[model samples]
Target chain A: MTKPADTGMTEASAPVILGQNSGPLSRAISRLRGHSFAVANLLMAPTMLWLLLFLALPLGVILVYSFGSRGTYGDVIYGFAFDNYLRAFSPIWLPVILRSFLFAGIATALTLAMGYPLAYFIAIYGGRRKSIYLILVMVPFWTSYLIRTYSWIVILRSQGVVNTILQWANIIDNPLDLLNTPFSVILGLTYGFLPFMTLPLYASLEKLDKSLIEAAWDLGASRIWALLTVTIPLSIPGIIAGTLLVFIPAVGDFVTPDLLGGPDTLMIGNVIQQQFLSARDWAYGSALSFSLMAILLIGIFLYVRKVGTENLA
Target chain B: MNDGTPSTIEQCEDCAIRLEGVTKRFGDFTAVEKMDLGIRRGEFFSLLGPSGCGKTTTLRMIAGFEEPSEGAILLDGVDVARLPPYRRNVNTVFQNYALFPHLNVEKNVAFGLKRKKLPKDEIATRVADALRMVELGDRATYKPDQLSGGMQQRVALARALVNLPSVLLLDEPLGALDLKLRRQMQLELKHIHKNVGITFIYVTHDQEEALTMSDRIAVMNMGTVEQVGSPEELYESPGSRFVASFIGTSNFIDGVVQWTATEGSIVLGDGERVIIELPEDGSRPVTVELSVRPEKIRLRESGEEVQPGQCMLRGTVRDVVYLGMTTQYSLHIPSLDRVFSVLEQNVEIASDQTLWVSGEEAILTWHPSHNRMLPSSGA
Candidate 1:
């Protein structure tokens, strides 16, 4: 299919006429094409600069400050110490960190159990209205996350929607305490992160070859057994992806816990926010956030190892 | 079909699979209409038709993928039409060889056995034996993505065969392979069927493959079965014009029922007449339409001598196609207003290497034994 004149002018045979070529700019462009690394670096320059300015610089400052101690006036102490690190890991803060992990884990599990069937139904059985179903799944995300969390408050308050309906129906003698509980916080997290779980799972399930399921059924597998053996195993990539998307953000989610949680439902994110904004203990705040990041990194590495790195990508 | 076929397809108890007035309709569009068929036990029965002719739909109904809109799909005397595919004692080899990508070859083959909760050692030995049957023993740990298309197809076969179902349904299973591989797999499949001895219900649009492998083939058209018989019976005595054109090349000529199969005269549209005859098969053709297979007709020099009672026509050679094994000549007969093709073997190699040239006048002749009447040709 090559043009006749271009056959002899292949890359290996083409003369690199730099001096007589057009102008210096064109010559430089041709030279740049020869070195793909230059083109790649040029393409990546904006993203690299953005990350360096916004992400790396802040993280570097935090790393340096995390080793420093708070002054008497809670300001200007520039000496390295293990005191902040030890305090970040102390018994006083341990409960909040552990609760953060536990809440995130439970919320992630709940979202997975809820999202998988929705994704399956939309992807497989949605048929001609699949797009509408998918849009409905994502309807909650169209509103602001803050507004959505606030709407949960309106619903879960003592005399709000559920309590009003139940009281009118006389299901219970008194209004139930639905707000300011771990359950409320967990429910909020699950609702907010549902689309995050479902979209990836839908992508995986939608691409699944339906004939594989038919083949399984033909091979004597009952419907439930076929789903267990065939459908779930093939959609592992989506499961892993959705879990990562929901679990990582849910762990440090301060808004849900702060809005819907009681005093007993405090998380590490709230503790970090208090140290930075309320107490103005920046050094300890940096220490706590750094510890959180390190723990998350370790947990991700362990999780990826158990699931096999191949499944994640 | 408008022309009446036998209404009573005798209910035989020994049939491995039977469709009784099974009609499948998607909305108003009927995919399969009142398909009554009987497949004998341990026979390689093929549902052959062009795409959208309901061959695959009929196979799916038998496999219980879709329940019949009307009537029963009986598997060995028991109506299993309403049962789900998993409950039916039959398996299907999907056209695309839908092997589970997550499972290796051994695990894929053992999947059906595992679903049955077979013991550990039995599952292991059976999986190995199935792999060996498909000649994929060395590739047990290889994922489906790792194997070539042909090998993956073999794995699919082993996966279905390991279940030992009473009937195996193949929906054009070799359709995805290259021609050479498809030919090889076709022979291997026939060999496997011989050893397994289970009734095989194969659905394919390829008439040649059906003729090669099937013990009996049911030719379907539109939404109904046109005819069903052995390969020889179909090629020799097609029941209708559709089967005649679909199965092989046929030059259909409208004729009058002047006499029985051994003697007849056809009155063409332009006041011309043609003579034909063929050996009778114990009954008179119920219709007057006649046809002859193209290969049964031979082309000779314009003035070649011919035996008595041999039908002859003169036509100009319009196109010559040297198809490696046989040279096909399309002759334009102005009197008949049709282009009749004549196939001749390419066995003679002359020093000049000459062949049939366009614009050459030639005489085509064939014994009337090749002339046959269509049973339902009146329609």
Candidate 2:
């Protein structure tokens, strides 16, 4: 074998400098300690640049546009005006905003109802196959969300697989009106966000000290009572996190409504899309978007104030 | 085979809980073999053993967490093998002190009482009383995370004790405390047991803790109980080698019986003999192992007179360990090829002229009654 590097080196043979304050090595150590602030700034530069370029610039443009007037040709005319915000708060948009909230709230409730038990099973009773079950939960995300929404269309259309099966079974004389309905939209939203709710619930339930449940049982609480008193209360953080994650996005979701909702089920997202793409009123669209953000922020603020932000995992 | 104790069924009449041939097995491995035990009313009983010795398993069976694979567990003279944990009148103080993090100290203590749907005033008064018992009366509003580990342990105790169950099972409740706190908690727990007058079944791996707190102890090994007795009885006469070595420092000498001499003296092989008093009709000519406690062996200086009824052996001192309370001497006897330990109290200074040092010949002497003989097989 070849001789290894530093074979001749020993601790005593290493160089030692006298007058520690004046040595280059001592200067280097002092500089390293004092340069930590500069190093932290450098480490954060990329993220700051990305946020400024993508998020801040777009939001600033929207804020500026919201104050301008809509031009004759549907282009944004640069002029100070409050007409767009005034129209945003008018009764014309009330139904759409309320509808969005209704759909989001129902979908969130449905997702939580279905997700908690599934997460509890995987975390508490899955045993050695926990990783495999978690992988199965995430497997549906590999497909594009658009393809998944389109697949629902294929399943729910009047002449699609579901109606065909029902007709074959003679369950009904005519196909049910399943497509382009608010029910279908809610179903789509629940399916899309189910994993988001389950993962956090699983994380919180998995880290729970199992002995608390045992102690509850030992304290004369039955199985159902123990679950309600100990397991559910301890998992409030996961419930809050999952609700925020599903509700915030489902409020602004346009795809599921665009494909699966009817005219009667128009949410604020569809209204904003119409303003931008069909009506070509960029200022009005920006105003609606800012209004939605403000409402969501206020709702989130009240929620966090009520539940306490420290509980968020 | 009778140790002069009453049968388990007869004992169960007045006992708080009794286990009759309880056996627990998990698939291919047995966690606890056939176990028969009874805990008397208002008694502090301890199941003492090392890890995986089935002490905790036996406690769990009594608490209704595990059902015995073979036999029944009786609580208050009624079989509770089919009862769920919630239906059983027992509470467990978990080793981790699993106090609810979300609930404040008062609410945690009131959990079981509230489940019983007691009146609101009754619940409040009981919760206050329980908190005061654990010396946590002022910290009622503090969450479990806000308190120290010792305080959390006290809260766990209060929560379990507030229900006033028929039996209280503590699974090494003080195993997580530091040395000083653990000692303090041991005394406090014993005091609480006396004040509550509840049957306490404690499980621990610390032999000293068991000795300090238990009124009766069952020493278990290899998923089976080796011996059961009071602390003094078990310490004075351990039934098996495992119990002797596990409970305290014991020196064992292996030899075959050569002959039975009159007046309860037995001659051993290689012309060695010991004066152990035995009954007149006792059997002989079988191999035997002798166990002696280190404190029982006296280190005699040169020219020390040997009294009658005292058996003596000469050995060379190999090493010395100076503990604070006592000094242990390791003596090597060349003829028997064994090292025997002798413990002496450190009341006298080591510089005294009578003290023996390493490599010095010393005579080890003890009374014949101090020698305990067990069969070689140890059953």
Question: How does chain A of every candidate compare to the true chain A by TM-score?
Answer: 0.84, 0.85
Model 1 alpha-carbon miss at residue B90, Å: 0.8
Model 1 stretches astray by more than 4 angstroms: A1-49, A71-76, A309-313, B2-4, B11-13, B255-262, B267-273, B278-288, B347-349, B375-379
| Model 2: CA > 4 A from native | A1-45, A71-75, A309-313, B1-10, B261-272, B279-281, B302-308, B348-354
lDDT of 1 by residue, A24-90 (tens): 8787897888788888999999999999999999999998888887777878487789888899999
lDDT of 1 by residue, B1-379 (tens): 6454554256455999888899999999999998888888999999999999999989888887788899898898899999999888898889999999888899889988988899999999999998999999999999899999999999999999999988999999999997667888999999999999989999999999999999999999988999888999888888888999999888877644565445666544332345665434555453466678888888888877766577777789999997667788999977777899888877794548888799998888887778776665445
In model 1, residue pairs whose N, Cα or C atoms come closer than 3 Å (at least 3 residues apart or on different chains), thus clashing, are none
DockQ list for all candidates: 0.42, 0.39
Q: On residues A1-313, what C-alpha lDDT tens digit does candidate 2 reach at each position?
A: 1133343354335544334356787888779987997999999999999999999999999999998977899888877788899999999889889999999999999999999999999999999999999999998899999999999999999999999999999998899999899999999999999999999999999999988888888888999999998998889888888999999999999999998989988989998999999999999899999999999999988986677644421
RMSD over all Cα atoms, model 2: 8.1
Each prediction's Cα RMSD? 6.5, 8.1
Chain A TM value for model 1: 0.84
TM-score of every model versus the real structure: 0.90, 0.90
Tell me the deviation in Å of residue A301 in model 1.
Answer: 1.6
